[model samples]
Target: MPDESATLALGAALWPQLPVTGCVYLSGDLGAGKTTLVRGLLRAAGHDGAVRSPTYTLIEPYELVGRQVFHLDLYRLGDPEELEFIGLRELLGQGLLLVEWPAQGRGVLPAPDWTIDLAADGQGRQATLAIQ
Candidate 1:
C-alpha cells in the first residue's frame, strides 16, 4: 500500500507479534518512507525520541517500552566483512533490529524475520511486507 495510513496500519498490526530475537529488513529507494514506517513502529512501541536514518553512524539504538531496539543503515558499509567489527552477534542479542540497506551485508547478516519493501509513488509510498 502506498498510503501512509495503510503502511502505518500494517506495522501496527505486526507490532505485537515482533519477536525479541529477530530482525526486520527494510528495502526501499531513497525517500520511500522506510524511516517513516520505523518511526511509526517506534511510536507504537511507546517511544518519544527523535528517529533518523543511521546513514552516517551506521546504527542507532533506542529503548522503547523496555525493549532494546536497534536501527541499522548499511549504506556506508565499505565491506560486508566490516560488520564483524560492529559486533553483529552482540547487537542481535538485543530485543529487535530494524535494518535499512541490508544488501550491503548480504551474506553476513542473519535471516530476517520479516522484510519490507517500499517504493516512492507521487507524494506517498508503496510498502510490501514478506515473512521469511
Candidate 2:
C-alpha cells in the first residue's frame, strides 16, 4: 500500500475473506495505519459510526448488521491477564476481533486466524497478511 487510501482499500478487500467470528492480529508501529485499515474494514462491514483506536479504553465494540466487531488496542496494557477482566474469552466467542499490539496479550488472547503487519515505507505504508 502506498497511502492511507490504499490501506483502506486493502482492508475492505479483506472483509469478504474473513470468517464471521475470528481474531485478526494487526502488527504495526504507531502511526502505521493499523487503525485506518480497521476503519475501512468496519465501513465495508456496514458500520457508519466513528471508528477510532481504543488506545485508552483498550477495546471498542461495534455492531454491524448481524455481526459484532471488537477493536482492541493493547498498547497500554501492563499485563496480559488484564484481558480476562475485560471478557476476552467472551468476546472471542461472540464476535470478530481486531487486535493492535497483539504481543501485549500473548498468552491471554486466542491465536489469530489472520495476522496483518504494517510498516512505514518511504512516504507511505506497506502491509503483509499472513493466514494462520
- The most accurate candidate by TM-score is 2
Model 1: how far is 87 from its true place, Å? 1.5
Each prediction's Cα lDDT score? 0.84, 0.93
Off by over 4 Å in 2: none
lDDT tens readout by residue for model 1, 9-122: 766777777777689999998777788788878877888879899999888999876688898999889999888898887897777989998999999999899999998777
119, model 2: CA deviation in Å? 0.5
Off by over 4 Å in 1: 1-9
Q: What does candidate 2's lDDT look like per residue over 1-132, in tens digits?
A: 778899889989999899899999999999999999999999899888899999999999998899999999999999999999988888867989999999999999899999999999887898889999
Please give the range of 10 consecutive residues that has the lowest summed lDDT in model 2: 86-95
TM-score for candidate 2, please give it. 0.97
User: TM-scores across all candidates?
Assistant: 0.89, 0.97
